[model samples]
Target chain A: MSTFGLWHYWVVIVLMMIGLYTVIARDNLVKKVMGLNLFQVSVIMFYVSMGKVEGGTAPIIPEQASGPVVYSNPLPHVLMLTAIVVGIATTAMALSLVVRIRETYGTTEEDEIRKLDRAEHE
Target chain B: MTFPIEAIVFLFLLATALAVTHLRDLFAAAMVFGVFSLLSAGLFTLMDAVDVAFTEAAVGAGISTVLILSTLALTDPREHQQPVRFAPVAVVLLVGAALVYGTLDMPYYGDPTAPIHKHVAPEYIEGAMTDFGIPNIVTNVLASYRGYDTLGETTVVLTATVGVMLLLGGLGGARHRGDAEVVEAAGDEEPTPMDRVQVARVSTTVLAPLIMLFGLYVQFHGDFGPGGGFQAGVIFASALILHGIVFGLSSLKRVVSPRFLEIGLAAGVLIYAGTGVASLFRDGTFLDYAVLDHHSAQHGRHLGILLVEAGVGITVTCAMVLIFFFFAGRRAAKSEEPGDRDRRVA
Candidate 1:
C-alpha cells in the first residue's frame, strides 16, 4: 500500500526489464552480453537490498559497543559474492563464443549470422 | 537516514541502465557500463554490503570492461541500428508487471522482521564471533559454514578459463613461449603507444607493486574486515593486468608464464578440495576445521579458513589473468595474419 516502502523493488524491476529488453531485441552479440550482464547485476542488487536492515551497519563485528549492535544479514552478501563471480564466468564464456561466431561469419549481428548459417545449409 | 541517498542512487542506476540499452556506439556503451557498475557498487555500499560492493566494483566494473573492450577489438564496436521492436517492449512490460505484482506481498526494504532476517542469519551473526572468532561474519560463513559452495564457485572460474582457452586457441602466443620472437619481445620493450607515456610507465611501475601488496592485505585481512578470497584474487589479478597494459603483454608473459597460469587455475581448486579430504582423514567430516589443530578447534578453524581462502585467491587470480591473455592475444594473432590489415582497411 505504501509507495515509499516498495519503491526500491519497483525500480529494480524496471531495471531488470531494461536489461531483458536489450537481450531480446538487440542484434549485436556484444551488446546482448552487456544486456545479460545488466540483468544479472540487477538481480544481485535485489538480493542485497532484501538483506538490508534499517539502522543496521555492515556485518563486520566491532570490538566493543555500548548497545546491542544490529548487523545487516550476512547470508545474502555471501551468496551474492559467489553470484558475482559466476556472473563474470558466464560473461567471459559468452563473449568467447561471440568471438568464435565473429571469426566464422565475419559478423556479430544475430540475424546476419543466422542468414550466413542458412546460406551454408542451402 | 538512507532515503535521500539510496533513492537518488537507485534512480541513477535506472538511468544508467536505460542509457546502456540505448547507446548504439558499443565503445560508448561499454564505457557507460563501467560507470553503471561503479554506481551499482555505490548502491551496494549504501545497502551495507561493502564486501559485495568491493567485488562488484572490481569484477563488474574493471574486469568486465577490459574483456568487453578486447572482444570489441577482435570483433566490432558499432551496433547496427534496427527499428525499435515493440514485441520485446511488450514482453518486458508484461514481465515487469508480473514481477511488481509479485513484490506486493514481499516485505519492505530494510525491514528487520522480514523472514530472511529471522531465519539462519541470526545463527551466523552470533556464532561467527563465538565459534570461529572472526569479526567479519560474512567471511566466516562464506569460508567455513558454506565452504563447499565456495569450492564449487572456484571450480566454475577454472572452468571458464578452460572454455576461453579452448575457444581462443591456447592462450594466444603464450603456448609458443619457446619461440625466440616471443622471448625477444619479452626481453626488450616494444615501442607501442602505451609505452610512450613516460608518466604512465613510471606510475604503473610504482603502483603495480603497491596494488599487489594491498591485494595481499585483503587476502589475509578478511577475517576482520570486508574482503576475502574472491575480492583479493581479483585485486591481485588486476595488478598484473595493469602491468600487462602498461608494459605490454610480452613483458607480462615473462613475469607469469602461460604454463604457470594453466597449472595455477586447477591448483586453486585442488587446494580447496584437498583441505576437505585432509579433514576427512583426520576423523572429522569434510571441511571440518576443528580437526586442523591439536590444541584448539578455534585455532584449527582459523588455519583452515586461511588455507581455503588462499586457494580461492590463487585460482581466481589465475583464471582472470588467463582470460585476459587469451582475448588480447587473439587480437595479436589475427593482426599478425597476412592481408588481415588490408582486409580491415578495406
Candidate 2:
C-alpha cells in the first residue's frame, strides 16, 4: 500500500468526526454552520481524491507528449463543479437565515433564541 | 515534489477550518473562512482540477466571504452560540459509521481499474477527438452530450442570483447600494482607500492582458486540455476581482454597470439555450448541433460546444460577481462602528 493511500482516508474520517463533534457540541448556530461547511468540504476532498489516477499529469496536456496518453478521470472535476456551486448557494442561504434569526430573536445563541421563541409563543 | 507541498496546503486548510469554528469574533471567523477557502483553492490546483480550483477560489474565498461578512453587518457581532446536544450527535455518528462501513468494497482512490472510467466517460474521451473537435472529455460532457446539464446549471446561477437579490431586499437599500442612511451608521470594519492593495503598475500592465488572454485561451483551448466553461468563468471573474481589489471598485463599476451585469447574465443563458434551439430547428435534439453543419460532424459539434461553453462562462462569471456585491457591500458600508447606536434591525 502506498503511504498516501493508507493515511488519506483515515485523516478524512478523523476530521469528519471532529467536524461532527463541533457541530453537535457547539452552542452557537454559526458554529454548527461552520461544522457543516467543514463536513461538506471533506466530502468534496473524498470525491476529488477518488478521481486521481496513479502517475497522472496535472490534467494539462504536455505539448511534447504524443498520442494516446494516460490521464486521471475528469469526471470528479466535473462533479466538483456542481458541488462548488451548491456550496456557495448553501452558504448564502445559511447566512441569510442567520441574518433573519439575529433580526427576529435579537440573539444568535441557540438556547437563547429558543427561550425568546417560547416567550413569544407563550 | 508534491508530497511536502500538498501536505502543507492540506494541513493549513484543515487548521483554518478549525480556527473558523473556534473563533469567538464573527469577523475574525469570517476572515479565517476566507483563508480556508483560498487554501482549498490551492488544494484543488494541486489535484489538477483547475476549473474547480478557480470556482472555489472565487465563490468560496471571494464571494462566500463577502456573503458571510455582509450577514454579519446586518446582525449582531457577538451572540451566544448553541451547545451540541449529545443525543443528536450519537444518531448522526451512527448513520455516518454505517455509510463508511458500507464502502469497504469500494475502489481505492485513483485506482485505474475503477468503475467510473469503465462507464460513459472513457467513450466520451476516446471518441471526442473524432466525434467533436474538443480534446477535453469533461468539456465534451458539459458542453455537448450533457449540454442540457450546463443549461440547467446556468439556470442555477440565475436562481441563486434571484435568491440573493430577494434575500437582500432587491440588492439596493437593505444591504449597501442606494442606502445612504446605512453607511452613516455602519461600523469601523471598512478598510480605508489607502488600505487597498494596488497591483504594481508595471506588473498589471504586463499581467492584465496576459490574464485576459489566458482566460480566452482556456475558453478556446479546452479543445485539447483539461478546461471548460466552469474554469473559464472563474478565470474571467478572478481577473476582474483581482483588478477590482487592486484598482478599487469605482473604476471597475464604471467599466461594468449593474444594468450591463444584468444583461450579461441573461445574454449568456440565452446563447446557451439558443444553440440548442438552432439544433432543434435542424431537426436534431435540443443541443444536437451536428446538423448545424452536417458536412463536418466533429466541427459542427465543436462549434456548438464553443458557443455553449462561452455562454456558461459568461453567465457564471457575471452572476458570481453580483453575488460578491450582495455579500461584500455590507462590510464596505461602515466608515465607523456604531456600538452605542440603538438601531433595532428587523
Which candidate leads the pack in lDDT?
1
Candidate 2's residue-wise lDDT over A43-74, tens digit each?
77777777776666544445676776766666
> Candidate 1 on B125-195: residue-level lDDT in tens?
99987899999999998989998888888888888778887777533444553223433433344347486
Write down the lDDT that model 2 would get: 0.67
Candidate 2: regions farther than 4 A off = A2-7, A20-29, A58-61, B1-13, B58-61, B77-85, B170-214, B239-253, B328-346
Cα RMSD, each candidate: 3.1, 4.5
List runs of model 1 lying over 4 Å from the truth.
A1-3, B170-191, B338-346
- Quote the positional error of residue B17 for candidate 1 in Å: 0.8
**Candidate lDDT (C-alpha), each:** 0.86, 0.67
Give the Å shift of residue B61 in candidate 1: 4.0
How far does residue B119 in candidate 2 sit from its true spot (Å)? 1.3
- Candidate 1: pairs in clash: none
How is the predicted docking of candidate 1 categorized under the CAPRI scheme?
A: medium
When summed lDDT is taken over every stretch of 10 residues in candidate 2 chain B, the lowest stretch is B179-188
